[model samples]
Each structure stands twice: as C-alpha cells, then as structure tokens.
Target: VWHKCVDIVTAGLKRVAEIGTMMPDPHGYRRYCFTPLVAWTADLPEQLMIACVSKSASPVTEATHKQFGDSHSHSSRTGDLTLQRIEQVARGTHPWNNLSRFQREAKTIQLSGVHLPFWRNWPFADPSIFLLPEILHTCHKFFFDHVLSWCRELLEDDLDARFKCHHKRVAVRHFAGGVSHIKQMTGREHRDIQRTIVPMIAGCVPPRFLRAIRAIISFIYQAQSPIHTDTSVKEMESSLQEFHAHKDAIIEANARKTRSAGTKNDFHIPKLELFHSFAAAIRNNSGLIQYTADVSERLLITHCKRPFERTNKNKD
Candidate 1:
C-alpha cells in the first residue's frame, strides 16, 4: 500500500525528469529545468523502507549486523545492484520460483520483497546515494534510546542525583527531577542532556566507558557543524573509531543488553552502523547541518499543528 502511494506520487516526478520543464531564472530568462532527486531526508526506518533494505542491513553499505561494530569500511550498495537483485527474484526459475524462496533470497541480500520500488524508474536517483543522514533521529534519538538507557542502567539512582545536584546556569535546561522522571523528551532536551551528560556520569562509570561516551558526544557535535572540511570529517571519523574502541566497557559493565536473547550483549545497533556513511554523505551532499530535521520540525508545529488547532471540529 505504501509503495502504491509512492508510485502514484513519483509518476509525475518520473515524467518531469524525462521531459524537462522550462522555468525562469533570477534574470527572468527561461531555461530548461530537469528535476532529479539529489537527496532524500528521512528517519532511519523510513530510509530502510524507501531503500528496500531490512533493518539488520544498511541501505548505504553491504555490512549487516555482524559487521556493524567492525571499524573496517564496507562496500557501497548501488541502485544498479539493488535493481539487479529485484530482477533476479522476479525472473527466478524452478525451485526458486516460489513466494517462500523469493523471500528467502531477498532476505539473504538484506532486501525487502518490494519487487518494484517507486524510484526504480526515476532517472539519476539512487536510493543508496540520495538517502542522506538526518541528525535529529540519527544522533539525538540514538543518544536517548541507547546511550542514555545504558548509562541509566549503570548509574541508576546516582545518575538522577547527579543531575539534580548540577548547578543551573542561564540557557541550560535544569532537569530538577532528573531524566528518568521525564515522560517525553524533546530534541532540545536531548541536546541539553548531551551538553552535561558526560561530566554528570564521570566518576560513576569506568574510564573506558566514559571515553566512549565522550567520543560519541564529540562525534554528535562535530556532525552538526555548519561547515565541514576534509580534516574536520577525518576528525569526526576518528571520534567514531574511538567510541567503537572503548564500547566493550559498556558490555563489561552489563549496561548493553540484547532484547531478543535477553542475556547476550552486542553492539548491533543500526544507528551505530549508520555513522560509517556520514563522512561520505558530508562529502557528497554539502554540510550535515543542511540535512537536519530541526527546521522541518519547527515548520510542522507552525504549519500543521497550529492550523489544526485553529480549525473547527466539523466534517466540513
């Protein structure tokens, strides 16, 4: 159903890409304008759906959960390769020409059974390439979801006490009741927590674990920079490497846990794997700041929420 909706929407885009449209420039001179999908800004789950890759597999790289924590770079996943895999499933013969077999084959390649993706027919649009990183969901949400949870497990009541004791300053959020009591946290709150979290848990967690937290915090801040250079990007990558190096301390402290197995510990986080593509994304698409969802989130409150509130509750 979702793919059908995508097909309906992209049909026009496909036509526009093929037959160029004429538009005026700043000087009012009419010129042929060809629209190609340069970048797609979405949260990780939506990105996986649009790119037709499974959660365990990355759309940007060939790496799966097993290789997610590995420091080595993985081979890129290309549109041509994705299309070819879909084609193979569609044209399978004999024993492979069944629904179960098709699903199994697709799973092996970390692809969903989305045989005909909307972007398949679109010109110069590669899902792997165009699906850019979003800082809000990728960094801020991950911190709250994984990092904060890990810290909470290790620190427990002490964590909250530290936050409660921290002196309040101008422009800084004061979590008077501490983080655990907060029902819902906004992006701004997440940013506020990031600012103070490293020092808040300094003496409580192991030295290696503290280093890991510090490194990830560094990476998150660096990624949000409005301007990025080759040197800056390398520094970002180094921070990620540093985090990966010391992440074992998290497991040793019994902070990280597997939801499925309940006892096993591993760093098979999709967001962690997604970090590997940030350098390439920054180089390909200008700065990471441009891809942030902050502006759009604000616009949602202004354009959607406010208007809905203003509207009368009627069928009309």
Candidate 2:
C-alpha cells in the first residue's frame, strides 16, 4: 500500500497533473471555516449619527460633531473596505441620519434618512484577514487550484462580461429595463456565444495549503494513512518545490497584466483571482468576489480638489 503522506505529497508534487484533488468550496456561504484574523471586526466603527438640529445649524457635541462627524471614517486596521466605499459613495451626506434618536421640541424639524443600507457592512473590499486554516481546507477540498482556475477563465471569458452585463441589466430593469434590453440580449439566453467565448479567458490553480484536513483525508484515502516513510518526505519536498513554481507562475501572469495595463491596481486581485480560479475549475462560471475595493485619503482628498484660478490676461 502507498503511504498517506506519499499519496498527498504525490498529488501536490504533480502540480501539472490532473488528480481530481478536492479543494475548498468557494461556493460555501454557511460554513465559517477560516475567519479573518486582523478583522477584529467588533472593535471597528458601526454607526454614525448625524444630529439634524433645525436651530440654524448649531454645532452638536464634540463626540457627535467632530472632524469625522459627517464623514464616518473608521480605523483602517479594523475598518471594512466595502463599507467605507459605500460611506464615500453616499458622499458628504448624513450616514447616521437613519439611526438618530433625538428628542426635539415641537418646533424642531427632525426626520431621519439612511444614505445606504448598512453603515459599513462590506469588509471584503478592504484589507481582509482570512484564516489560513480555511484557505488550506478549501485548497484541500477543491483539490489544488483546478476549480479556482476554471472560474477565473470563465470570468475573463463569458462569465465576467455576462455576469457584469446581466447584473447591470437586472439593475437597470428594476428601474429602466426596457432601455437596456433594447441594447443587447442577456448572456444566459445565448448558449452558442457563451461556449465559443469561454476558452479565451486565462486560467489558474485554486489557492493551496498543503496540510488541509480534507485534502489530508483524500490523500490518505488514496494511500495508507497514519503511515510515513523516507519516500513520503521526499515527495513532500518535491511538492513544496512545485508549490513555489506555481506561485511564481501566477505572479508572473498577473504581473504581465500590470505592465500591459498602465493603471496600477488600487487594490489587490490575488484573492479575487483565486476566487475566479476556484469557480472556473468547478465548471461553474457563476461566481462573485464578495469583497471591498476602495479606501484612499488621497483619492478622497483629491475628490475634494477645487480649481486654481489662473491669471494670464495679456499673454493670450
């Protein structure tokens, strides 16, 4: 019988091999496998209350109406990126208008309105901390990066455009459907086009963690568990070497894009790229990167930039 370690290490060692290794399920919504570490979620900002006093705009308490009064800026270390963007998008408006609880006199004009649904619930867009265990578990369950790579292919191909367009159409349909429908047909309704386009997108392996339990189980099943030998150790070494190679390949691939597209990535796409790969391998082109992507004092400050007056009268 083959050794357990040898089996898994063998699978991992063959990075280019098609071993049907079950990696993590990116589609999982209920399982809280890996938790974001730095998230320290609870300590971050939750709600901001903008007291709308109609007494000719009297400044409220310092705790309430401070520098970030209208602007609900949270600790970046703990702030959710997506939430912050929504706050930004809501723009210079009252974020806490909906959750305000103030007792006003009969003459005070007081009512509440929320600029967006949640004050700052989307964290994926910001710097997120994911549990290594979860990533590992996922890698094992999904069997290397095959599933993830497949998803990325779809995204770069039919899935990304189709999903984006479909979502856009759906959104427009809710308020202005007829206009978008007239523009083009939805992606799903046309199978021939989708099949033709899928092959063109890039592909990658799903993320990995060598010792993921599910992966361990499958590898063990393929061989003899609770067993180890010199061969197993050698196999593991080979796997690690291949791991480094694949990592370099992925970096090189993404790096090419950066060089080609002069615009620097304001946010990291590694995780999203991993998501793409996972979705693709499962042959499921439909996937979403549930994360945030905007948070910049520079950008925000720039948005507040005003025009400088030029005085060149006689020259022209």
Q: lDDT values of the candidates?
A: 0.86, 0.27
lDDT of 1 by residue, 122-238 (tens): 898897789998999999999998889889889989999999998989988888999987757889999999999999999888999999999999999999998988999999999
Best-performing candidate as measured by TM-score: 1
Q: What value of lDDT does candidate 1 attain over all alpha carbons? A: 0.86
Q: Report the lDDT tens digits of candidate 2 across residue range 27-141.
A: 7544323221222111111111212112222112111112221211122222243334334434444434422322222113211232332212222312222211122222222
Error of 1 at 271 (Å): 0.8
Best-performing candidate as measured by lDDT: 1
Off by over 4 Å in 2: 1-138, 141-155, 158-226, 255-316
